[model samples]
Target: MAEEPRDYEALMALYQAEKRRREAAEQNALEEKRGREAAEQKLRPTNLPEFLDACHIHLHASLIVQKNPTMSTQGNPDNAKNKLRPERLERWEDFAKHQMAIWDDIMASDFASKRQFAPLSALEQSGKDLRQQKIGSEIDLHIFQRDTVDKRVSSIIESMYYNKELREKFNLLGTVNFENHANMLSPESQLEEGMEQLTVHQKGKQAKEKQPSGSTDTAGSSHPRADQFCHRTAAFIVEYKAPHKLQLTHINNGLDEIELEDIVQDVVQRKVDDKDDVRRLVAAVITQAFSYMVNLGVEHGCVCTGEAYIFLRVGEDPRTVYYYLSVPEGDVTDTTGWTAGLEGPNRLHLTAVGQMPARPSTPSCGQAEKRHQSSDEESGPDPDTPSRQQSLSQPLSRTQKTTRGSSSGRGHHGERYHQIDRPTFLALMRRQLADDLDTDCDPVGRPGAIGVLFRVRLRSHGYVVAAKGTPAWFIQRLRWEASIYERLRPIQGIYVPVHLGNIDLETRYHYEGICELVHMMFLSFGGNLIGQHLTAENKTLVSEQVKRSADAIHGLRVLHKDLMPRNILWNEETKHVMVIDFERAEVEPISAKRTWKTPTGNSVKQGQTGPSACTKEIRRAMTELNALTIVIRL
Candidate 1:
């Protein structure tokens, strides 16, 4: 057959086909290599962030960062749909590859030689701000004792980044009851024998007409009956160690055997009986929680019912409302019991039921009157039906509006969370704490996160730990911050000491139980350049430093998100400024092309008015860091 002369067209076609095959193979290989090595650079700079910048890593915690891949986890409100999608799987793979690169680099390099922890001056007893006056007004001065941090992050804890074989280290913490743990007090929804995602429920939405109990078992009910699938699962929350709360202040503290649900039952009964005082207090508490949830990217799963009790520590505008999912065995009341929940098609009904302000005309039975009204339209309003009030609470039209919030999923780029050993994390933190310096933000606190500031260790140059309570809402923010810093910790001195590592230990003296969320982070020391007067040399240095840090931040394709004075740390002693505070940081596209633009008077003057002039390619538009203007033009 080869004896026949091949045509020129046939030979050309064969060559082109071979060329395409080779190109495809090359592309696949290139992608595989990129997945193997860091596509750009490894995370955690080589001996990154010198002394002053290192100290703030504890104070601001997320101040330090290096170039690392972004992380995001897949989640759906419904538990059944919580598994990772194909895109999420790719992200997860990339995250693993990124972490492995760090480990490999750490192992292959002389990391030990780079462990010079001397950064900021040792913590002093007075705990006074070196530069007087508050920075953010977010810091709680009451908790600013010189020695408070020493009491935290005791000697026994191990680093999570260094410890490889964690076999016997947790012996002191007792048989770490991994399974026996509490999570937002949601009762166990353990499957009985065999439960599938598609449970053969035997009822429909209109099945409540025949029975008073609303318990009629209809064959193959359209409504989803799998408890696991129905429990409003926020899978992402548990991706990085399900955030757990040990204790919260109980509402009916005076009553010896009073559970949170009991207090709710009392409050609901009183409101039903036209108790104006109780109704006002209860409504205020619930409304506040709803507003808070809305701000944090949540829309449902809180209702005013006896089974789901809300314990409140109410006094100020920022009140603490604790959500307890289920009551004790005997605490279930007639108004709310085991089966009393928002279920079936029109969900969030229970919360809507008792939410309206009592009408003076029918104050005693306003809820009852509303329930009848709701049922008449819907045919069979199950006892667990969402009332008119609950529907009003999460206004259908409002939730439909797309919003970007702490709890809301960033669909295309879901926030990535890292899962590493506790000890391995502690090792990295132990190093940062070895170079601790105190940091303070707003004297009171940020809007969502609570009274928090990383207190420097007393006199000892040891690992600095952020000893502050963070709200559950802060978890996503903290995780986001941690991801940023973890990926970029290798970048040389880009941010202040941001997030160091996770800390979990057994404290002997003060907190008896093994501390849960003692996540350790190094905050660097340079104070913001607000109060300090600057010379010409210093002014030039500050501007250059600010621009440099901003450019570095932009290089990671992550926005400082907040490029302002409060977050800009200036160390007079070190003669340089470092960027801090990444709680609100967000990611965007990075570009290599640059377009030169003439600096206009408007662009320069906007510096005072805080006007941002957007450019097409790079979104770096804010007119900020004018030392001339910031010097307070006396």
Candidate 2:
């Protein structure tokens, strides 16, 4: 065949080997180019000269050195290398030097010129020369230097010279001009101008002095008179008179002796209206006298005028006029109702006798004794009694019977009269004991109780002790009171101690007996010592504590309807307080679904019940409690 096909397989192998060699060379060239680019991108210079050198090197490297095709395609050793001329290198060195020189000139031009301070320095030197020669003898050297620097120097130099006395003096020497002797004002002319100003000032002052005064003495002869008097009946003596004629007169031997007069003369002499002047004079006199009395260790028992009275006694004292004077009959009745059973007019009588001590005697005691002794005398039944009993014993009407039956159907029927005597009684007693233990003990005494006493019995020993029978209502009240303390126990450091014994219902009425006992205890202690009476500052503290307590009770709508002083306990050591007495607490839900009776007997729902309702209720309770405390004079 056609020369054995010329060994086609071997020829193909040779062609493939050549192709592989060419592809490897192209890849190598591309890798070399990429390496150069990466090196240039990452280059960094540490100094200015180094950075400039790097920039020159990069610029030259970026320039393309074109290949010479006229030489040989394979290799041309002689034409491969072409270098820059020696003159061009020399020219680049000169360009760099010129650039450096230009930079130096720019830096030099940035600095301010020295001519700005040249004139100032000349003036300062001339001033120094004049001062040395004593040419301007009247000029103050210290003042001139200070004014020249402070007023004339640039702010930059002033700040730099601050707090440096020598530097400031040097700056002044540089800034002030005192060498222009011909331009200075004459000392005689300056003195003449100053004299003219002084003369004008003096004339104005004289004119002002000659002007008539507008003041006049409106109080022609009024003078202040102040006096203090004490009454055995605790009455306040309010004296009203023209200040000039007012005097303190002592009634000894039925004759007046002037003890003090014109005590407040200066105050009364002030040009004021008669009412206002009198008030001021009286206030001054009272304040002064009060201070004097305090200094002398004399306590004021009462303060009173014809229309008002204030008592400062430790306890309820009938002899104190503040207790009785000008009080409305109804108010008095309401205030003193709690004491009715103990010392009311029905129980005790007082007759006025000449200078003799008025002794209290119970009018009902004799009548009670007579009734006790005559119990056996009434034994016979009369025919008139039988006839009267027949009418009284008539059968109840159908409607009345139905009403009575319906009332008994409810759980409250006869509940008040139910006796609490059983195993449950012991449980209740234990609960009461636990409550007493939980309460904080009062140092002075229990605030709202007649007395707190109990009896303890040991198993092996005889009865240890016993106390007087406490009223049933009082004990029930103590139970309610204990619940309040429990609710308030979470308040930090609030301590309210419930300390009392078991109540004896056999010998006590429910309501009146307990109320009287509480009233008596309060009276005995001068006031409720368990935070029933609080000052303005203490009231604020209590109000804040109550707010916190209310917040802690429920998220919002729960309110403590009764926020009285007796219900608030303060712990001084802990600086904390708590609210007690939740007997009147009611939950005001988000919806107005509850009804309450108004004082007028109309039913009304809690309006707009929400968190706001709770806050409002608390505020209202606080206000009502405050008003009640004030009315009771606690």
Candidate 3:
């Protein structure tokens, strides 16, 4: 053995050969995995929910890595979005983990918000079902539902492998994609010739994979395949509710005109069609995504036109906005940055390089979503169980039994949503106002930041009626109003405006979760008191009302910070006077002294040294102001 030490060269060669053989084995195993995945993909479910559900049961569940807990809403109102530094982004995996955090929040926010609409009875009933042995336990219910969806998914996948099942269940057509199939917003774009032809992989109803070179590049696995590491894009939005990516619904392509910025402008200014809409929109969006997305291969957003959308879900805390054609791509490059030969939307792509698709809304011609008019797509009333809430749906279309590549003859599973009954409520208001406004050019009313007040015929009927929104900035005012009325409610004889019901819109602004835009109707004291001429009798009535109201609010431990001529309503005919608009109302500590700047620009004080420093003196001051306004008007 000692004499054989001279044979080191021969041993080195042998070692090299064994290394090559092991490498070959890894390559073969990788190829086998690719083949098995391809075969499975051919039998994939029709949409994201079904496919992901199946992926779960198949033990190949896609991972959703977590990121920061509270993204958009966290930190200072100052410096909210971390600036886009093409340097900070290191991995598609990190960006994805962050997005999952945000997307999870958005979806959860949506589901939880909507779940508020679900009846307690239904939730109670679900518990009862468990207690009654209808379901073995809470886990059993989950398992049952998962199993139902998984069974369907398994069959859809299996149908592709078994000719008898495939031939019997599906039409000899093509697979579906979510972009078009889940598209509930609008119509389909016209297809060009040769777009319908069957490629080698799509010869059957399922799609083809790994076609080299032309329109698609080594089309790894249509997004969200088992072996596919990156969720790639489309976290199930225009939206995503499921964990799968069967449909391009998971990824919304910025292929059409986007009105998202308009919504942003509206959110910022609280007005529709403002001149500063674009400037404000650009400022907000750029500020939000620039810091983070720049490093992720995005230079800036579509500043010329807002061609962007935010991806949010339940589990994640931060929501991310993606630029057009910018999505994470393959492993051609190392995990440290963008793939080889990858630039950005406009270059500077240091790390997370994304693909900006030069296409329209959908993924494929066969699986593309058919667009329709949102207002017109109505599901006719269901008479058997006509619950007003359940009768409404906006995005979900009526179910049609066509061959949608389901394993059974049934169509894709249709989801129903609740409709905000604005039309019915508005019509009733219009009629109520019509009977009240005498001859004031119908349907037109004076609009304000919080609400639109209509001079209704009801003023002559003794009270004023107004329909208005509690704006985000003015929410504190609304809460104050509610509290004041609730306090004044128990005090006798002061006119507290009678509140009618409010219709809640399911949609929310892009701010914090608490600030919702809701329309409330209140029976006020007078109609447009700002323009009203307070007669002698009206002065007497208003003086008495203000005096009592001021004194009442004090005993209730409150301060009506905003006091003006307009706030004290006057109905000359009925000599009815009432105070309104308690949004700026405050309930201060008994020992604390505070000065408030009222709407009239007067520095009124409870803590300051005014003639009326507290409530009892405040009423006397209101009486004097009422007298002066009445004299000035006359």
Candidate 4:
């Protein structure tokens, strides 16, 4: 019964070939790792900190600020007085402190203090040239109005952007737009009192204008309207006023001398002297900045007079505007460790301005976050009775939906999100997922470190698309989840949400205290929680649907590892159950059946099990689902 010598030699040869193949595979994997690391290194921007420092330095050097000589107020004097007043003015106590903390962190980091890149010398020289051009008497003649101030600031901002290294470092997805084209801020919105006049003028012009012969109404046209509202991706809002109109002295005297509460009342009652007049002027501009901030839903903005920059932030309340004045000429000193010795006015500090642009890159960082709704209240809204607003209000948090406080108890559940049709969603994905989409509302489900689930609407077609994303660190896990969805494509839009393609976001989402996720996976809204519509009448129906969904997944050899009632959704209209959250789910591996020799020298095949592991997991989930149903019924 001994094997032949030639057979043994053949087996040895096969073993050697297998070993060689393993070595080659290992070598290829090593090469791939090296390639990835090299690519990452190349993509990583160099001398960004140096460039930011250079921008601040050059901006201060080339700065030309002239005061307006005219001493007059526009519109009604009463209106001017009213414009300066807020419903309530509360001092943002921690505005400067928090900005300084970020600055300190930047300074303490290794990259901030590193040696300058080679191109930075050329960049600084260009800045010096700009400073030289502004040295003449022509600078004296130039009135530092909104346009002038914008040009001066934009010179530096543009310079920072043009540099390939700095753009990469900041991850500059959105532009620093001087022009405010937001539909909410448009004249028709009437965000400001005087805007009604502008709206009337526009309407009158529209009436006078004739349409082309045989042309239908733009709104009624089958084609997309040319005048459709387009959201300009603004990194942050910058409100500029002439330096002479709103001076550094005005801000210092108005804000420092008077309490915010008193300032509001003083402006309203038309109380007091020259100093109060200056305060009223400062307040008017601050009020303007607040309006723009609320309309845009951006938490941070700056009111930049040619001379000084008033870094502003809004907290949980839309009306409450926080201000921190930064005077580049005085506050920033050209010393070896000036940042270390700075007392206040951290806004224009090199580190602070440097860090500011990166805020939009990480949209959630350093902003207040709304509380996640508990599982009991995660059912969302009933489709039959959709009590929702026509337009979105500015949320307190960067990514949270608006909350209305009413005794009707609807405020506690948060705003209901509008849904997009499947055809529109597919068209958007086909075009470009990242470029076409913009964050519409707050996050949908509970956000974990691995990923954050939120709703993003299409830019041209305004309809919400559910996006699941994670930071680069957790991208693999997100990819894994996406792969699982791909495997379950057969049941998509039936027992699960439709799987839209995945994409890398054009811009990075920076959530303060949370991950800055760049990778996004798009999916259809998977309906609401199972318990939301689970009742005595539909309990059997719900249970059958849930069981059917579980079976469908199991049939695909996919095990729903973390299957629970929270992960299951029941669509009331469709009366179908959809399962979600497959982060921990696994596709069962396929293997050949094993044959073993018995002690009696008889060949026998391995016995089959009562049920497969995938089936077992489904059964276990069903048991938990049944228990949850019982609890809900009670």
Candidate 5:
């Protein structure tokens, strides 16, 4: 009886242990399922601002600011800010009201919000503790200082640019540290003597590739210099003054109260020597930002002190600048008051979202319109010209002329070259190339692509370039593509983009710790992808165009191995087709045998010589084009 009792107790204990294990496993599976569901829910489409709000990136940014509060420190030894002189400076009383009106207009319009960046946000938030902990530590443990400020600002800006949705919506690229890095294309004096383009294709010669030039500005430059330069041509630059150097009191003081002459003459006469003068310090920093904006020919700029953001915009007269100071800690709030949306003194300003008051319009196709009118005037109006008006009107919807002009020269031609001064064009090219590259439109390549294509517009003259950027390690592919472009030189503007040149951009684009872009090859913008616009009506036309483009490539004794729909482009206005991405192309020798498959599934080989051989060579190249053409047939 005693032995039986002991056996029963042992069995019961084993059963209880197994039941507990099963229960724990069930709970874990349920939690994981819920987690997956939450992630999926977050991935639903949203706008940039809304998505940012949900992800709490801006909140975390605020936390970073709170944790690393600004500390007082000694001013810079250079006293450089005092020397800044702008042609004119003014703080319009109606600036904030004007900005609010623009916001209202934007909100009332049929504005399309960009898609969500949930995955990206999750990745960005990973490895960092989200829970409100670990904020306070010993000074020896947590080293929050000036560097932390740079990292935070840089991180936020970089993260914004990385989001393809945000980039497309805002038409922004990445930022460049002009203080530390050189412009990719510098003046002759800025570069080493006899520094020529690297023979990148030559094996083992990669080691000799020219490193980028050090920091150098224009000669006789008299403008205030900023640390960070954003967007090519410095259209939108940002100046970061450490909070220790620039405080809230300085920013809070209205520039309207101080006389422009008092500030400018003081700086010029070297009378504003007191580093402790709060009003003088504020004036100096604003003047500094204004000078950079004027010299860069940009209208928009920002002066950040980590705790404060001062948004500046130059007026129609480049000399006159307007400033709006925003302190997020004091300005922004969770609650929305009854008069929140109203345009009044008590109206709320959501400055954290980086919304600016309306400005002048953007670039349009006026040149194209001019050409059409000239042809009409020269050749007389055709009956079909009226019919073609609607088609022409599509690309010319934006009527406002671009404010972007070069101080160095007349101006630049856009994607399509017009007869212009070659010397002027060359000068503009050297001036426009920056350390970082970003597209104003959608990127053709995915995040992890070896070669990403960006449609970059020149800031000076709005000349668009199809910039193909890749990491330095992938320089060989770029070299190969460049050679292929050279071989297709005869069809430069007709069937392909004009090869501008190549440069090694020292700035690195980071994403998921994968790779960084270090080199950029500039070419003219080929039109949109043909595959995207395939309609029942234009299918046959598209097919024929692709075939013609392929024939042109084949005539050069080159085989474009990849001739899919994605590789083909159609310019609707020009009625011209273009083929790109010659990375997989192969050049054949004169004696090499050329073969292609016919529509009847028969193998055909080209002759060794004569016009018949040329005809047969095209047939071989058309093998791939057959598949592209068949897309329309189906």
Candidate 6:
């Protein structure tokens, strides 16, 4: 009745097929368009090297046209009679080839090996001669002299390196010289035509005035004028009269001569300015210098003058301090010495401190024999002296301990030991062990024994063991640290030392060394501590570390109570992170039992005293140990 139901199913299928076909065709067209665009991009000559070459050629041609305006007009001699001679054309082609060769060499050289003034080397060799020859032919071309050549060359090089967009604006070199002068034929023309055309386009009419004449023999010594630009916080101008002869001046409100004199006389002389005051000044200067370098995007060792001088301008006063760097006088093949010099006055110098060995003086045999006889006479111990020495050397017997009371306060808590000598303690250890200690165990293998501590290697990767056998009570306190390390060893990124053993007789509780501690810390909590080493991209690392620390605590049942700077170690080589001193860590199960003492002497206990005392004490000890650990992330 209704046209035999119109074949509804077949018609629907046909419509679906048509829609699919159209979609497929459209997708294929998009794919083809993308491929074509990519290919075109490749052919468009976007390579930096090619672009720079083209820019150099264009600049070179423009410079030639401007310097020799007669050639541009003579080439079309029928209407305008100025033309380039056959010999001049050949010379220009030769110069262009030389420049291209030099440019290629510079581009091919490694960035690390390339000097700052590398691009100007070729210009220095031939630029002045070329300008002089051009000016000699045309007496009227005095305006485009030696400085003009330098300005043109410098402009092109700077644009190529610093201003890529400007260089890329003119893709192909053209000869339609845009002479914007009010009167094109005027004898006193304000605009100079030719290679100066590019300069005019970039900087307008003032370009001619700014162009540097390549004739300056000492262009390197031309320091930027004080009025040019400087940061308000920290800035300095270093002028060098000769190689290794320099004058440094810092421009800042703080560190003025008058203020420094006042500080030295009123504060330091009067003994009123404590270490804190000196530290504050040092810190301020360091911070300002760091900020200044970072803002300028300069490498640490690149900006220093040849003589390595740094001046600090005193804030709020018109005075400056000239800090003379005492670098070793020799051929400074290494850049580290230059870098250290830039770090300012606090750099350590062993020679300056009188720690370096003094020259040996020869003694006569007669003088030596006389000294030996005197020593022999003095070595004979008197009866009273021997009894006194014996008494001093005698160890406290059990009877003496009984008389002093069995509960002697020698090893009691809060007991402080004074007048302990490092050498004596080391000698005692040697006597107890009856073996020679490894020379490598010493810090830096130097003469000084003060602040000496043992470094022990661990079996696990990224773990070190440290120990000191000082006071018995202090050594006992270290046992708590051993317990903390044992608990935290299993946690990822936690660099707590494994409690290998505590030799009570030797009073040495072994700890993992700092090297391994740092390695593991980076692996576990690297994102947080990575900023300590990476200055440029620190914000990202800092944010990541904070985020990770929070997430780890929330998700992995971990707690890093000692989240200070020193507790975190970042491995520079592997970029791994290690979190040390887990004496304060508390897993989720025992988190409640973590007790922290308040400033008001009130004890904050975490759980039931009887049931959780053991776990609570352990956590509490860890928390206390964390507080004791020094934080030095930087």
Selected candidate, larger TM-score, 4 vs 5:
5
In model 1, how large is the Cα lDDT of residue 382?
21
How much does candidate 1 score in TM-score? 0.28
TM-score of every model versus the real structure: 0.28, 0.23, 0.26, 0.36, 0.38, 0.23
**Candidate 1 residue lDDT tens string, 1-634:** 6634567668888999999999999999999998766522223231212211222222222111111212211221122121111100001123223333433433344432343333233322122342232221101211221122111111101121233332122122211100111111111111210121122221222221112222212211221121110011110000111001101122232212223344446667864343433333333334333332322222222322221223222112322333333221123222221121223231111121111110011101111112222111122222111111121222221110111111122223223322223344345445443443222211111111211343333222232222332333234445556566554554423344434443332221111111112332333332333223334445656666666666666566555544544445554444455565555555542222322111111111223111132221123212333433333343
Top-scoring candidate (lDDT)? 4
Task: Put down candidate 5 lDDT per residue, 169-227, tens digits, no spaces.
Answer: 44544532222112221222123312322321121111112333542222222223444
Q: What is the C-alpha lDDT profile of model 4 across 161-206, one tens digit per residue?
A: 4555554554434334233221111112222222322321122112
Off by over 4 Å in 2: 1-543, 553-558, 589-604, 620-634
Model 3, span 1-634: residue lDDT tens: 8657758868888889999999999999999999887666444422322222222222111122122333111212112233322111111224344434432332233221221111223323333443332222212222332232223322332333233333333321333222111100001101111232222112111111112123211112111111100011211222111112111232232122234445455667777543343334333433333332222222222211111123211112123333332222221122332222344322112112111111112121122122211111011111111111121212111111111111122323334411123343335545544343234311121122243333232222222233344434444444445556555655412333433334332332211111233334433222224224445555555566566656666666666654544355443433444456665565544454656544223445555533244543455446545545544554
- Per-prediction tally of clashes: 69, 7, 44, 9, 0, 45
TM-score of 3: 0.26
TM-score-superior candidate, 3 or 5: 5
Candidate 2 accuracy as lDDT: 0.28
Q: What would the per-residue lDDT of candidate 2 be over residues 1-634, giving only the tens digit for each residue?
A: 7755677767877888888888888889888888876554344212212222222222111212112323212211111011111100001123223333433432233221221222323333434543432111112211332232222222223222332442332232221111111101111222232332322112221221121233211221111111222111111122212111221111111111111123235345754555444333333323332322222223332222211222221112221111111111112221222231243221001000000011011001000001111111111111101011111222211121222222223222232232222233334444443345222211111111223322222112111221222232334434443344344434312232211223333222111101112210100001112233345445666666656656765443345654434345443433444444343455444456766422223455776555666667567646644553344343
Q: Which scores greater on TM-score, model 5 or model 6? A: 5
**What lDDT score belongs to each candidate, Candidate 1 first?**
0.29, 0.28, 0.32, 0.49, 0.47, 0.28
Which residue runs does candidate 3 get wrong by more than 4 Å? 1-446, 454-465, 491-493, 501-503, 507-516, 519-533, 536-545, 571-574, 588-611, 615-634
Q: Which stretches of candidate 5 lie over 4 Å from their true place?
A: 1-36, 55-84, 108-120, 123-234, 253-256, 264-276, 316-319, 333-351, 356-634
Poorest lDDT segment (10 consecutive residues) of candidate 5? 362-371
Candidate 4: clashing residue pairs, number: 9
